[model samples]
Target: MREVSDAMGRPWTETGRHWWVPAVRGACAILFGILAVVWPLITLLTLVVLFGAYAIVSGAMAVYGAFRGVHPRDSRTWLAVSGVLGIAAGLIAWIWPGITALALLVLIAAYAVVVGVAEIVAAFARRRAGDTEWSHLASGVLAVIFGVLLFAWPASGALALTWLIGLFAILYGASLLLLAHRMREAGRRGAAGTAAHAV
Candidate 1:
C-alpha cells in the first residue's frame, strides 16, 4: 500500500472539512436504492437513466471533495481517479441508454469494484494516520462484496438484480452516512480542542 504520510503527517480526519459531500452522496445512494427496491418492475431505460444520474452525481461529489480539501496528494489522486471512473461509467450509460441487461450488470460491477478498491485504499490511509473508525472500511468491504456477488451471478434475472443493487446501495449509503456523522463529530471536537488550546 502507498504510504499516505510519515509519522508527523496529517491524518485523514483532516479531510472531514467537507463531510457534507459524502453525506450528499450517501443520501443519493439511499434514494436510488429505495427507488430500485420499491419499483422492481421499473423499465430498463429508467434504470439506466437513474443509475447514470446517480453515478454522475456521486462522481461529481467525489471530484469536488478531491479538489476542495487540503488532504494528502495521494488521497486526492485516488478520489479523483474514482470520480473519473464513475463519470465515465455514467456517461457510457447515458450515451447507450439501450444497453443490454448483461452489459449494464457488467458496467455496474466494474464501477463498484474500482470504487470499492479506492475507498479501501483511502480507509487504510485513514487508519495509518491514527483515525480509528470502521465505517469507511466497512463501506468499502460491502462495495467490494456487492461487486463480486454481481459478477458471480451475471445471469440473474432483472428483478433479482434490481433488489441486489438496491440492498447494496442502501447498505453502502448507510455506511457513508455513518462515516459522515463520525467525521462531523471529529471535526467539531477538533475545533473545540483548538479553541480550548487558544484560550
Candidate 2:
C-alpha cells in the first residue's frame, strides 16, 4: 500500500539537505551564550538589546530554514510562524528597551512557548514517520521547559534571567549541533539508497 511504501521511504529525511541551517543556528546560539556568560552583570537595557539581537538572528535563521529545508507544508508553516514571532519579539524589545524586566520576561516566555510548541509538533511528525530525530525532540522539550520556567517565575529578576538564558542557549545550541549532524547522516543514507536503487 502507499502508506506502507511511504513509511518505508521516510521522505521527511530529506531535511538532510538543509543540515547546515541548524548548524548555523547552533553556532549563533553558542556565540550568544558565550556573550551572555561574559556579561553576567549587564544592565536591563543592555540585556534587552542583546536579547533583541539574538531574537532577530534566530528569527532570520528560522525563516531561511522554512524555505531552504524540504519539509512538509505543516512543518514549514510552523517554522515560518515561529520565525515571524521571533522577529516581532525582537522588534518590540528593541523599540522599548526601557520596559521593565518582568515585561521583557513575559514577552520572551510567550515567544518561547509558541515557538517551542511548533517545533515539538514538527519533531513528532518526523517521529511518526519513523525519522527518529532525537535531538529535535530534545530541543523542543527544552524550549518548552525553559518557557514554562520563565512564565512561572517572572520575579526572577535580570541576573537570574540572564543566567537562565545563557544556560538554555548553550544546551539548545548543543542539541542543534547534534540535529545537524544527524541530518547530514540522513542525507548520506538517502544518497546511498538512491545510488543503490539506480544500480
Candidate 3:
C-alpha cells in the first residue's frame, strides 16, 4: 500500500484534509472588517467587543487546526502558538474593555507581530513539506506589514485606526479564503488520484 504524495512528495492527505479551518477564520475576519467599516464611529468598548469576538473565533479555529490538521510537527506548534496568542489577546480585550487607546494599540500591535511571525514560520514549514501555494506566505507578509504599520502610527486617531484595521482584516480574510479554496482543490485532486491509483 504505497502512499500517494503531492507534487512535492508530501502526502496529499496532509494538505487537503483541513481546508475548512482557514475558511472559518477568513469568514470571521471579513465579518469583523465589515462591522468595523460600517461603524467607524464605534466606541472603545464596542471596538473591544468586536475585536475580542473576532480574535477568539479566529484563534479557536487555528487551535483546532493545529490539533487536527495533518502537518509537520513544527507547523503545528507555530499554528498552536498563534491560536493561543489570538485567544489571549481577545481575553485581554474583554477583561479590560476600558483600556486606553494607547494600551489597546500596543496590545493589538503585539498580537499581530506574534501571530505574523508564527504564520511566516508555519508557511515555511508547509513549503518545506512541498505545498506550492504561496497564499500562506503572502498572508504572513501582510500580517507583518500591518503590525509594523500599527506600531509606526500609534498616534493615529481611533477613527483612522478603525479604518486601518478594517482594511487589514479584509485583505487578510481574502487571502485566507484563497488559501482555503486552494487547499480544497488540492484535496480533491489528491482524492481523485488516489482512487485512480487504487483502481
Model 3 scores a C-alpha lDDT of 0.82
Where's the lowest-lDDT run of ten residues in candidate 1? 1-10
lDDT of 2: 0.78
Off by over 4 Å in 3: 1-10
Judged by lDDT against the true structure, how good is candidate 1? 0.81
Pairing residues by index, what is the TM-score of model 1?
0.91
What are the lDDT scores of the predictions, listed in order?
0.81, 0.78, 0.82
Between candidates 2 and 3, name the one with more favorable lDDT: 3
Residue 176 error for model 1, in Å?
A: 0.5
What's the TM-score of each model vs. the native? Answer: 0.91, 0.87, 0.92
151: Cα error in model 1, Å: 0.5
Off by over 4 Å in 2: 1-11
Tens digits of lDDT, candidate 2, 1-199: 0111123344555667788888987888787777778887878888788778888888888898877654445577788888889899999999996899888888878877887887898787655655666787788788899999988984967557787878888898899899899888877777777788899
Residue 51 lDDT in candidate 2: 79
